[model samples]
Target: MKKLLLFLLTCLLAIHLAFPQPPAIRYQVAEPRLADSLDISHYAKKRGLRAGAMVFGLNMGVWTFDRFILKGDYAYINMHTIKENIKHGFVWDNDAFETNMFMHPYHGNLYYNSARSNGYNYWQSGLFALGGSLMWEVFMENEHPSANDVIATPIGGMALGEVTYRVSDLILDDRKGGWSRFGLEFAAFVVSPMRGLTRIINGDAWKRRSTSGKQFGVPNVSVDISMGIRTLELKDEILDQGMGIATEIKVAYGDRFDTEETKPYDYFSINANLNFQASQPVLGQLNIIGRLSARNLVDKPKHYLSLGLYQHFDYYDSDTISVSSAKTPYKFCTPASFGGGFIYQYKGLKNWDINAFAHLNAILLGGSLSDYYKVDKRIYNLASGYSTKMGADFIFKKEVFAISARYDVYHMFTWKGYSGEIDWRKIEPKTLNAQGDRSRAILHAVGLRADIRLRNRLYLTGTFMNYTRNTKYRYFSDVFSNSSEGRLMLTYKF
Candidate 1:
């Protein structure tokens, strides 16, 4: 649930940037007063305070957006890796292999083990993430964080926040707090629902209680399912013709060891995809494609599958520890989803003129990676994600004339923790015991490309991106605010 909330929140952040109404273009009247003394200590202290305040303010703003906009979002995405993808060198390979990830955040296996602990709730911590995210927006104003964005964000988030808090209180007292406040505020930025009205969905207090929401994975069962259709191939005519169908599913469950030392959130997942296509289509110029997927659904969600699993570590620390302090990944487990759709298109413009698809995916993957452990997995559908921008695509030049963008603001719906007990490693080899676990990090990508003729069948492309980040037990869900760069590739064929 936390993961779903985070993903939806991130999507909202992007939407907030491009709201329907243009913001009042306000120019900075004057620079805010900075510590002039330049005394190193005073300067540092001043900066720290400013940072904290900005963080708080920004968080407040985003949360407000949730209340006003999306109302609340329910995340539905697959976060798992198939053994075949790994064997085929398609998995996200960092430093570790054959590891029990998600144990740290999902089950608290790496951090607390057995000592039951407790701390801040979702609202309090959300305040922290929002504060920081907003601060960055401010800094980006006129400069890196943007002051205009900060102001607008707060206005939007606050209006939504007030309504959400009052509503939560009016109907259910137990569900009111920083988490729901944060959830409602953030949800708005993603979906407007209506001009002024708000949509309230997924108020799962009962589910929260049943799952014991936190960072540790203790939920008894987790059922994740995804089924849809699309076209990998296309026909020259209509979009529904000569297409394909596809589906994928996964599930997991575990308990026993409340923390890493004694036991861990033990579980497994099954993922499968099926596709079928026709040989030819309209004008005998295209082909048909189809896909199907099936996954077993369980009645409950595992601790790792619930919202509280990832933040479980916060319960044991003074403030909060890093997701990997204990060396557990706490990701890589998922439920099942199997379904597929179709599409059709034509060719021969520039590189090829075409039209195609249905029920596509706008998939995004994430987690963490560091020197201590790697987490790039458990990123619901951690593999290369391809979203439904399943429309007609027309390439004007060679493949190099690639122009692709997705504007799905109107359609579709979207999409941890630990224990402390004992270290089974002491008595047996690692794999045999589920007592303690960890997940580990980074990729560098740079690509530059040039188009070549069919005979050469060569292209030049370059892309550069690599980053390492640590998610604290209480870190904000919208942390794409912290990003770095790294890698490169180019090719020429003749």
Candidate 2:
């Protein structure tokens, strides 16, 4: 996990250093290539085979490291163990929250990109992730397969994978040559290695040609990178803990108001944050909202409204903080979620803009901190439920000032748990006795932000957010907790 975070930080820093200023904007429209087309029948079997090989290679490499260097017992697998695992079926494995929630999804991203970069589209690449996860669970590891992993890997992989793929596309340009092209390719490789590898194999890394245009149709994108200091307070206290150096990268891909055509991820927004503090993970939060489809209801000179189906991926993890009499460990995520919503934009006097959205999402599978149940190092519960989210932005449109506010509410229910009388210590690791801490948790969050443009592409931003969790347990008293954070940042937009 530390290594993964470090790699991510290094990549982001390299991008920042490479492009001190935004590149010249170019608009290109070209006919879609057969490889990039939506038709699923035009699959490349060779690329698919290569993707499969890569998945097998990754599984073997990890197993080798774990078996030899780490000497981990779980890495030791045999035909008999594989047979046992197949017979045992799916169970909720007790692994660290970060390992299951963060690392597995990342691994799945690699699997997804293996196919995505190899002439496969969004929907087709997802199959590689699913296949890769199944290979690892049934053939690579000795432990029984996990229910949460199968869901998280492919679904979360699609979200993160597509984001990286688009970001890489935004970086690569075959028209440029020499150091300029080399630098761009290197940065894109850092973001998506599988794509880089495929490019190398196909001799496109250094081969400069007249611009054939982007594989995915060119979409206008806006990027903001921010650096700042943030302080997290437990309950309602101020400055109770040390501050952390916070950095964030926000990307808005494609124009949401463009109602001419709608695709799976044509309009998506991503928010990724990193915190350098003692008590927090290097990755603080990663949120993705991608529009799957849309229909224009009202289109006018002053007002535009559209209804759309969206895909949501949210992940938040923090260390346990004592708040009053409660132990609040801020760990909640919805790796697989689908929702429908409406997007309304009002262009008032002097080009002023007001944007608002409301969404109701069904959480297929999610994780939240548990009150009592603990197995191995796992203290989070796996559950299914729903959420309601709404947000609005008041942009002065003068590029000078903007204010935004958002509210989110989640309701989750855990269906698999053991009684308090059961001897958890004697439960077999391979058995599906206790899935997680059985409880119902409701999480509510409110956030506000203000941004002032300090320069042409620079802004000073201030943000505050408060989170509250209420967990009701079957065998224990209810737990209620609160946490809040405030941040001041300097943001550069591209």
Candidate 3:
């Protein structure tokens, strides 16, 4: 249920970016800030105090629910608990991976959006996330402050919050009224509840006007949704998982090659794959890459090239599969990363188009399924390393037929682990502070995809991918595994 909600939240981040109103415009202006000539009547005046208050109120509301409704032990906080938490400082927490990795970030989004919707810029709003997380750790819970939560919450929140905030802004149109206006407002509300509440409180929800609500100039946008079947094979000798439902959503927000925007996420692309009963993770993978800065190298009639800095958020999760003798869950993620990359585009005779890119990033934080680390339902090792990715796409007759290839490789090194001399039976449970398996892992994937247009805005697509993982541990024998996956889907583009 939680995964489903998160998937929907991610979808909402792009739903409004696809609004088809203004014609696509290139970001010729190098400055990241919106031009002063753009209309500001739709947005409220900056209100820093109000934004702070809203963030605090949001935290209080969540604590109220956790304290009274669900009545969890952690919710039992008092003045004494606050002092204890302060004294303990910070420690690695044993909460479930989903809670630390996904939920905390979502909560921080509320904090960030509170400031963003009230007219705060991206960097300024990030402070709200950091402050809000600190308050939650020190005041809202009886447990000690978490080391991982502090790192993941604010950073992850800023990335995700900006995406949703941008989408909501595009959805809000003060020019329309009646049911149309109500629907637009509702959709924006769904995307960012804090922003929606601010709108209602500020009386912008029903206020009609002649000016469009867009703050930033609209850029070219493409949204693709696909649905079909997927198959997965865990091991070469094991039987493949039977066919199951698979759906994908991809959104490209701007003309990357043409954009001169220096702001983060101004030119970005996000892709999400969801599987249902396909012997795969319900939320299989979510990959996001947002441009931070870019410089065009060559811009000719038939050839274009650019180099850019990007921020990345990648996630992969799967349940444990026990087939005969195999019993291992699949998980790998890099929630925060930054990198540099180059993009090349070529237009040729006979209506042919080709695009390619290669990127290398330093992973600030990463996670992988662990073989030896298991503390209170946590079995994933946290590490920091780097990754390299490259891909290319070919389009013929303006998308009548298309094919793409991609390759990704990741190298991670875990920093926290127990000594080999320690006996498993003698080790105390939950006593160690994130003493995970000391190891280094290398994971890689190669994929191929083909699409055939059946008609306008519709296509049939097929994909095949192979994944491999190799891990070397200090205390145990090395582990190696690989999997193969295939998918066939019908897609619609908007």
Candidate 4:
């Protein structure tokens, strides 16, 4: 495993160093016919294959990295600067320095000869820029945030501004910052690290490098309290933009774990989970998500349209829980999942936003260190339920400190990759008592998220989530299972 990880990181580095193209390398893009002897088909095939690999690797890594990066740069602005500076300014940002000649963000494509050289419609450039900027947030975690939800991350909160500009171009019929562009940009940002990790970590295996200690909640308020200590080590930077170096060994500790008792325990159990992302132009977006949930532990969800870069709501993002009595030995620790999908956001609205993204949660292989981790049968088929969510994110910012909120309804989708109900009991026909197992899951959820500033670095956030499921099966005996869980959280920026 260690060797594979090391190799992947190295390959990611090479791809980013070579291709470095942005705007999702439009498949529709007509590559000007080269006068040289190189076959365009061969070149395209190789590029696409490598791009897909790197995209997958970085996405998997970000699946775990995105969780801890919620500490917005604004969190620092509130801490280092005076309350009045923040109060008067309202919004916190490291605006373009005097040296910024291009109208783009710092990490944006500055090459005058690149595809963007011709200039982009709003949605085209907007998505890529926002996606890149958000990816930069990975290394900027100075505090803590939620582990399960990506939008809860500070990077997510602030990315709204960048995404806004991208969205504006679309509603106006300007494809400049279109969703496609945002997706491509996000991919560029992602590939940089995965490739670099290949050059950084000396081993081929992946591990959950740390745990979480942050505790936060806000049950009765417009916004839940988001508070914790999230951390990541800068490991590598293979991208020319000086952004792919992740030398810090991405790690986290003390990310709290919580369970919603309203129904059967619905929560994430964080056991110091860790993962990596390759940042090559073609390799950077690939991600590898690690162990269970609860803390802003695993990486946060990535943006829409950027497939292969693990998403905030990826299907396999969580550990699989069993409904049988035999007790799968791996239940205590969080389960790790591997899957991929994409996100697409619509433009044409000021604060009214809509996003559509999907992912597949393959199989959950979760367990503790000592008792689990066997060779061969190491993975448990918690394929009980799969989740798909559709929602809209709205933004309302007017100098008083930007405010944004998103609400999503998650549908529990099962049958695909489902292991069926755990019938721990095997009965004989002569026993006169046979009970086959059955399972049914509603897998529906409603989530609401918000962020506000009482002043400066002193910010507040709230999140409310509810998940419910009902399962029933028949045999010699009838079995019915129903569970509902809700999490309310609050945080105060230091």
Stretches of candidate 3 above 4 Å error? 1-38, 41-44, 234-241, 278-280, 348-350, 423-430
Provide TM-scores for the models. 0.22, 0.87, 0.88, 0.28
What's the TM for model 2? 0.87
Tens digits of per-residue lDDT for model 2, 193-265: 8778777877878877666225654677767888987666623332345367888877777777776668678
What is the alpha-carbon lDDT of model 3 when measured against the actual structure? 0.75
CA displacement after TM-score superposition, residue 385 of candidate 4 (Å): 6.0
lDDT of 2: 0.75
Off by over 4 Å in 1: 1-95, 98-394, 397-416, 419-455, 464-494
lDDT digits (tens) for residues 1-494 of candidate 4: 64564445433322211000011101111222212222212112222233333334443344345544763343442243343433332211121111111122212322111112122322343333334334433322332211211211222212222222222211121122457544533443343322223212322112211211001111111111233211111122211222222111111111112112211111111111111222212111111122222222223233224333221212111221222222221111112233443445444456443444344543231111111112222221112233333343343333123222222222222222212343335422222111112223233334444444465434333322333333332222322222211111223322
The residue pairs in collision within model 2 are none
CA lDDT scores, all candidates in order: 0.24, 0.75, 0.75, 0.25
Worst 10 residues of 4 by lDDT: 17-26
Q: Write the residue-wise lDDT of candidate 1 on 172-221 in tens digits.
A: 22223567745643453232221112112223332223211223222333
**Descending-lDDT candidate ranking:** 2, 3, 4, 1
Error of 3 at 390 (Å): 0.8
Poorest lDDT segment (10 consecutive residues) of candidate 1: 311-320
lDDT of 3 by residue, 1-494 (tens): 64564344333321111111111111121223342233564464689999999999998999999999999898999899999989878877776666766677778888999999898888888899999999998999988888778777887787778888877866778889999999999999999999999989999899886666677746566677878866555233333344478888777776777756667778777777888964555778777788888998899988898989887777777665545435454677787678999888887666777788889999887777787777777888888899998887776855577767788898998887877787767755545666368999998877777767798777776677777889999988999977655667787776
